[model samples]
Target: MAKIKTIIDGIEVEVERDSWAIDVARELGIDIPTLCYHPALGPYGACRLCVVEVTKSKWTWLATACDLPIREELSIKTNTPEVIRSRKMAMELIMARAPRAESLFPLAEKLGVTKPRFKCRDDIGNCILCGLCVRMCDQIIGVSAINFANRGHKRIVTTPLHKKADKCIGCNVCVEVCPTGHVKTLDDGSFRHMQTWDADLEMLHCLICDKPYIPAKQFKVISDKLEGIELKRICPVCRRKETVDNLRYAVVEKVS
Candidate 1:
């Protein structure tokens, strides 16, 4: 509730108490790379790419910018030599686990991580294990459909028993939130298939156009939430067209 003054890269700024250091940095046009941070989800500090140097009196230490709370007179440096080194090391370790992941290439270049020192792993695919998908399903969607399965190096995101996830509504929230393109979905008119989770879902077709737009289960979840909205079985495109046509008719009637 209260505002506090903090210094980021020698630029003093006033922000709300308990505000994340990363948010303030970005407000000042400072680029702090992050993989696990989502506006709708809580900070997990999984990727460690957003590490920054925090100076409090005589003590100086590296802290995750995503979860670092801003306090009065807090001093932070995002691109110091130590911070860059830590980020480079973290990126190398992440790249080794997902060497073929194209999404990591830009960040790797920025950090000067030419090649990972560790052995490249082909088993994990592009998953950095940031837990964004899992948390989105559990915290926001409340589905709890997919989760981290194995332990240690064998850990992976999968459905229960590695079979069809009955609870999956085909909302594709996981796919949208995933920093890497690991959780893939394919819509083949008739079915929406989540290849990663091995789940097959029936598509919900638009009533007027007869084209599949979303999964049936996902529609039901949305319709249930809006109990008295009188939801029409129309796709977004058709809905927008209909709204415009109605507005035109109303304007004509008023002019006449």
Candidate 2:
């Protein structure tokens, strides 16, 4: 396997070649903060919170750790004063755009953002414009229902023509990954609702326990892939318990 010798915080560490700074940092037990970079998705450097200082051959500059590729003899400083200042600025900027993002408060405090200095644009709403939802819909699920629309401060993520997209499979992956609560999956125990895209999918109850487990659309997607193999309509817990009970009964019958 290809490898690269990198120096991080004055310690020599070896990591896989072509790996990003986040991957190398993680391998060295370092936790680099990230917002738009999900393990299941490609690196999108929309959030500049992971900025880090890198020096190679007397040249030094800051780069986003999530997208910065690992190179041979690369030296990185994740907690330098300059890096801290840049990260704090990025946090404040994101906070300004997403003041109602309760999920960001912890990170904001960690990055030394007491209060955002930028003016709040209520017209922009609470989204940080990270594009995680759009990327997930396009890359993972193969459904490009939503995308970044407009330009600059006018930019927003929404379905085409700002209407409910019919191609959406009702997967809540977008809502699940959104660090800011901008995307919503509202459920009142009967239906799984994607509020932004206006997808109201009926939730399916478990056959064994009759508790709502999955959305009908999501289930249909999975079942369609499986073809003739009919999946059991039981939640994970009930499935395990039923399997154990059936096994016990079979063992008793064999012994008899």
Candidate 3:
């Protein structure tokens, strides 16, 4: 791997080639505010909060630090006036989408965005369109139950036909990956519910104790991956107790 020499916020640093500007900035202790960029997932650059001014050769322009690759000799400014203005605008846009979202409010206060310039449309939750949930579902979980629909401003994340997909296993990967805490997962009775995708899954109970442990869909997916491995559908506590009893019985028989 080649090391690219770069200047970030007036400090000259050597960053690995093909690495994102945000990653390199972190290495030099530079804090670049980002809502969409997650280390577990690829750069989506939807938030536009990590914009930085770059000057290479005759060109000096703004680029998203999350997606921007450090190539060749470059001079990057992380907290320039231009960058701050762009970040403020991005924060305001996110605030307009999710007004009451507490996560958005903190970022708004930091960027000096008191009120959203854009008109309020609907009472959508704190989904900042970071795409972590969508990416985690499709790439990590291998379940494409939800995705972006429509175009431009009208576009929103939804399930197939805006109804819950049968493939949704109630894994809550979306809920965990969501940055703004928009998605909510509730375990009620024999079902696991996800509010964002409008998905409800039947819970699977332990065969021995009849205690609900996991969702039926999640169990099936895990069972499929485990080749030839037997699953008794028993809770961990019951399994341990059963194992101990069987071991004790064997010891008594051997001693006799």
Candidate 4:
């Protein structure tokens, strides 16, 4: 095992190499709050909540601890006044953008950020787009149906071609990973829609089953493909079972 040394909150601590900065900080009784940084999912560093000041030689820069790997002779400052200010600013910005959001409000309050300094934009009402939803879809579920479209301030997540996304696998990983409940699937196996006051839609399909279950709008597309197929009326699994049973009966009649 490689030995690593890092300074956190002005105190030096020795840790194992390949360890994440957040895990090392916790061992030293330092708390770095985070969302979208689940242990199981690893770190996407999208929330920007786990930012830390890292000093190496003459360079001092802000880095996300959740994404940083431990290295020898590294200096990390988790709770410096500057770091606290930056964290508060990030919280304020996220809060202003998603005021009524469930997860972020509690974290903002905990960080002692009560109000935003700048005037809140009317469009900043939902989904800060930290990339948690997109990452979960691409990384965990292996479905790239949802993605960040546009660029910079105008960047927003959407399906392919801004049309109903036929590539989605109907998995709810995006919904589960979304910090705000903006991405959600309905009861039917149709498409997932972003809950906005305006009408913006996204869609997905099942990879294995090939059933048009999710995304109601895309149902027509899938239905058209199944129009001539004998198994069109039922779902994929039921269709396969029916075919197997029919083949068995045909074989038995031939034997008789």
User: In model 2, which residue pairs have backbone atoms overlapping below 3 Å?
Assistant: none
**Candidate 3 lowest-lDDT run of ten:** 120-129
Model 3 Cα shift for residue 199 (angstroms): 1.9
User: How do all models score by TM-score?
Assistant: 0.96, 0.91, 0.85, 0.67
How well does candidate 1 score on lDDT at residue 33?
93
Local accuracy of candidate 3 as per-residue lDDT tens digits, 128-152? 7778888888988888788888877
For model 2, how does the per-residue alpha-carbon lDDT over 1-256 read when each residue is reduced to its tens digit?
Answer: 6788888888888888878888878778887888999988877788998889999999999999888888667999999999999999999999888887888899899999978999966766679999999999998887788999999988999899888766777788898888887888787687877888887778899988999988887788788879989988998899999999999999999999
lDDT of prediction 4: 0.72
Winner on TM-score (1 vs 2): 1
Count of clashing pairs, candidate 2:
0
Which candidate's TM-score is highest? Answer: 1
Highest-scoring model, lDDT:
1
Candidate no. 1 TM-score: 0.96
lDDT of each: 0.91, 0.87, 0.85, 0.72
Q: Candidate 4 — which residues are off by over 4 angstroms? A: 9-13, 27-29, 40-43, 57-60, 188-256
Put down candidate 1 lDDT per residue, 70-119, tens digits, no spaces. 86678999989999999999999999988988988998999999899999
Write down the TM-score for model 2: 0.91
